[model samples]
Structure formats: C-alpha cells, structure tokens
Target: MATVPSSSEVPPLAKYLASTDKKTRDKAIKQLAVVLSDPSQVTLPHSDMSKLWKGIFYCFWMSDKPLVQQALASELAEILLEIPSTSMTFDFLQGFWEATVREWSGIDRLRIDKYYMLVRRFVNASFRLLMRMDWEPSSCERYNSILAQRGGPLCSDDIRVPTSLAYHLADIYLEELDRALGISPEPSPSPAPLSTLLNPFFILAARTPTKITYDRIQSVLFEPLFTALTPKPDDQPPSRKKPRLSTPTYSNLIANACLSDPKAEGAVESEKLRKALLRRIFDVASGEDTRDANRRKMYNLWKSHMEDEDSSGQTAVDAS
Candidate 1:
C-alpha cells in the first residue's frame, strides 16, 4: 500500500533552484513563494536552503532581470516573517544585501519610487530580525572598520546604491529608535542599544559624501540626536524614566563612523562634514544640556583633531 507524504516531508525547493533555465528557476521561486505564503510550512534543510539562496543569487547576479530579483526579495521578506531564516541567507549576507544595492545603484537603473518600495522590503526584513530577541545585527561592526580598505570592495562600487539604501535605512533605523525611545508616562522597557545597528549605514555615509547620503546622515542621525537631546518644557514634569540605551549610543556611533571614514583622496576639502558631526556629538552626548561635564571634555579630543587638520591644510597650501 502506498503511504501519503507527511507535512514534515516535502520535496526540497532546491530542485528548481538548480535549474539552468530562467523559467524553471522562476517556477522554483514561485514554489518557494507558495510554501512561504503559508506560515505553517517547515523550511527545507540548511544545505538545500543555502543552495536555494545561492541559486537565487546566481539568477540575479548572472542576469539582467530586476523583476526576478524583486520577486525573490519580496518572497524572502515573507519567508523571514514566517520563519527565522536569516541564518541560511546570512551565510552570504554581503552578496545577499548587495544584490539589491547593485540593482538600484546606477542613475539609469531601477526607478527610484519602485526601488524605494522594494528596498523598504529588504531593509525591513533584516531589521525585523535585528530587533527580534537576543542581539542586534552584526553587519556594521563586521564591516565598518575595514570598508574603506581593499577589504571593502563593495563600498567602492559606485556609491549610489549605498547612498540610496543608507538614506532610507536611516529613517527606518531612527523610526525604530524613536518607537523604542518614545516618551511614556510610566517606565517603559527600552530595547537594547542599537550599538552597531547603524554602523554599516554610517560607513556608507562617511565613505562617500554623496548629497543624498549626507542628507540622510544629517537628518536621520544628526537631527534626531538634536531633537532627543533638546530641553523639554520646565513646566512639564519628567514623568518617564530614561531609556535603557540613552542617547549616547546613537551619538557615539555616528561620530565614530564619520571620523573613521577615510579622507577623500587627492582632495583639498576641509573636514567640514565630519567635524560638524563630531563637534555636535559633544552637545548631544552632554545629556539634556552641558550639565554632563564629562561629555563636554569629550569634544576636546575632537577639537585637537580639527586643529591638526587645519594646520595640515595650511601647510599644504603653503607647499602648493
């Protein structure tokens, strides 16, 4: 007698993932989509799943098809919501993340509006995982220190994708921060410090001075710090407790990212953008005012760096 297949045992999605033809691979994508569309499905084995992810990467990397990639991203977003799947995908995290970046980077590439919607899907998916439980995403710490070096080949790739993605991710990151840090009448639970959460993004903002990246860095990171550290009306009593993370994590992360980015090559520009951010960190980190004397002294270090840069600029001018 023939037995019926159990729910735990379904054909692996890898079969279609390996197909040579685009149509066949698309069929596999649709099949994965069908499975992910339902929350009850058990995911395929890790090896097969990685293969499936790599296959998706291969399909995108090897083709000129943005639609295919968009479909994969959309489906991956749903899969993540259903199952904790970043592990399989994270194995190739850079490639996985860069796929969309490369897609949307160039001026003549994907439409910004549509690209924005699609990128929202990607960043949101990763961010959801970032905030889920034990720890924040490690992408930033893993990448920031080395991104400008030859180690960060992707950073050198045009910078447009980084600019665009960084801009949007900042808003989302800050929005999440705001929600986590929003004022409450009673003591509220604060999420863990996003420590390195925005690090990867600030590297992008730092590595290049693209207008859009600059805007996002300023608005998302700087403006929010300013507002959060702003003095409240004295008439209103401080009813809520301070957040678990406080404002320093955000301020320090942005400042460090800016300072860490390599200076522009062969350029005579002053460190205006980087210094502006570092200098403000002094005020923001000062805690509700300059009352935090320790934080005030923190800016002294940056002040010395600014003077050093000024001296170097003058020397260069004299030599020229």
Candidate 2:
C-alpha cells in the first residue's frame, strides 16, 4: 500500500490561518505568532516554514479583520526585530504599511486607534533595528514617504498618531547613538530642558486620543512650536540649501511637541517660540516650489550634517 500523508505532515498552521471562519482563522494566526516567536518549537521543515509564512502574509494582507491585522502587525514587529536583515521582512513591512494606510483611510475612530497601535509597534521596532544597524538615511526616507502621502479627509488626522509614534522612536535612535559613542543616555535634569520640547511627541503619537479635545490641539499642534522656537545650535549651520528632517525625525518632533505636550510649560517663552517654528515648517511644507526640489534641499542639508559630524570625529581620532 502507498504511504499515506498524516495530518502532522500537512501544513495545518497555514491552512487554519487561511480558513473562512473568523474564529478558526484567528486561532491559527495566534498559534503562528507563537511559533514564529519561538522558532525552536516549530516542527515544520524549513521549506514548509517559508511557505507557511508567505501564506500567513497573504492572508494577513487580504483579510479585513482588524483583530487579525493587529495580530499580524505585532507578529511582524517581532519578526523585524528578530531578523532585521531579512529582505523578506523588509518587503513584507513595506507592503504592510501601504496596505494599512489604504485600509486606515476608510475606518472610524475606534478602528483608527486599533490600526494606529498596530502600525506604531511595527514602525517603532523597525526604526530601532535600523538605527542599531547604522542604517539611518534609508530608515528616514522610508518613514517620510509614508507620512508625505495625503490620504482622504481623515488622512491628515490619521497621520497624526503615527507621526507621534515615529518621534518617540527617534528618541530611542538618538539614545542608542549616544550609548554607542560612550555618552550618557540621560540628558541633564534641568528645568525647562531642551528635551522637554522633544521627548513627548513620540509618546503622544503612540497614544493619540480617540476623542478630539482642546488638549489634543496643544499637544499635537502647539508643542512642536516650542521646539521650532528654541534656537538651532549656532554651530549647526543653516543649509546652503534647505535641510530636510528625516521622516522619523520630523514625525518624532511633531508628535512629541504637538501631540504629547499639553500644558507646554517650561522655557518661559515657549508660546512665542512655538509660533515661530510652526510658521517656518508650514512655509516649507507649503512653499510654491516643487515638492521634489524642497525634499532634495532638505536631504542635502542632512547629508552635509552627517558628513560634518563624521569628519569631526575622524579629526579628533587622528589628533589623538
């Protein structure tokens, strides 16, 4: 008699994930998440494992279930952190973000919150991973492109939460860089510190309120005002052209300042500063000039700054 294939030999995980029933599909997704979480426990062969994950992603992309999408988002973040260099992970994340934005544009407030959290987790993890690998420029561009797109009427509002989350991620990026350079991660605890204007944007973005409030306006719109108002370092030369803030950086700044900081206390003259910075950013963002030209100018400025910092470090090393 011919040998028969057992249930154990079948790809139950993938099959279950692709099921028509919501309950069965969700259970399978959770199981897959667990398996992916601990690869050692996975009994599936390597080839089969690849197929299973691909199927899972397909299901993830095609399904309309928010619960399933949220699960997939968390799993994707974990996967990105677990395997930062995988091309598959990158492709999946890029596709996932695109799909998420499309779906998000059509949802109500509750759904928006759910989608925001899911996307935030993945984006945050990805940023941290990319920074750890010394991949800054690409990371910045990836985030910027996502935010730059104008969704429908809700698009602007929807972008706010993600923007704030991105800001918090940038803080982590800066902290990691400091640690790598053997510097203290903690800034001075002075009253009205520069960080006060910077730290909260990310947190706010990650936790944007479902209900609109006056506080939201202050946190999400006005707080960044303080950051812009505070003087750029004299040593930090103005771009011979315009300088572009990376998406992650810009998002982080906006979220922390505009979305998170409600009271806007500190730096006695913060209100004045906030207004100035807002005006400048608005001008650049809405300038009559082409968007591409504006972006190039911004990129050159950041590129130059990176070059300057690198050169300064090398010089110090050579002298030592």
Clashes of each: 0, 14
lDDT of 1: 0.44
The stretch of ten residues in a row with the least summed lDDT in candidate 1 is: 261-270
The 10 consecutive residues of candidate 2 with the worst lDDT sum are 311-320
Q: Candidate 1 clashing pairs?
A: none
* TM per prediction: 0.46, 0.39
Candidate 1: TM-score?
0.46
Residue-level error in angstroms, candidate 1, position 308: 26
For residues 147-242, write the lDDT of model 1, one tens digit per residue: 333323225235344555555656666554444333322243223233244444434444443455545565556545533433346785653433
Candidate 2's C-alpha lDDT?
A: 0.42
Instruction: List, residue by residue over 105-187, the lDDT tens digit for candidate 2.
Output: 35566455555556566656654454443343454444444433343111234553343334333334333322322321324
**Model 2 spans > 4 angstroms off:** 1-73, 84-86, 106-110, 146-222, 225-287, 290-320
Specify the highest-lDDT model's number: 1
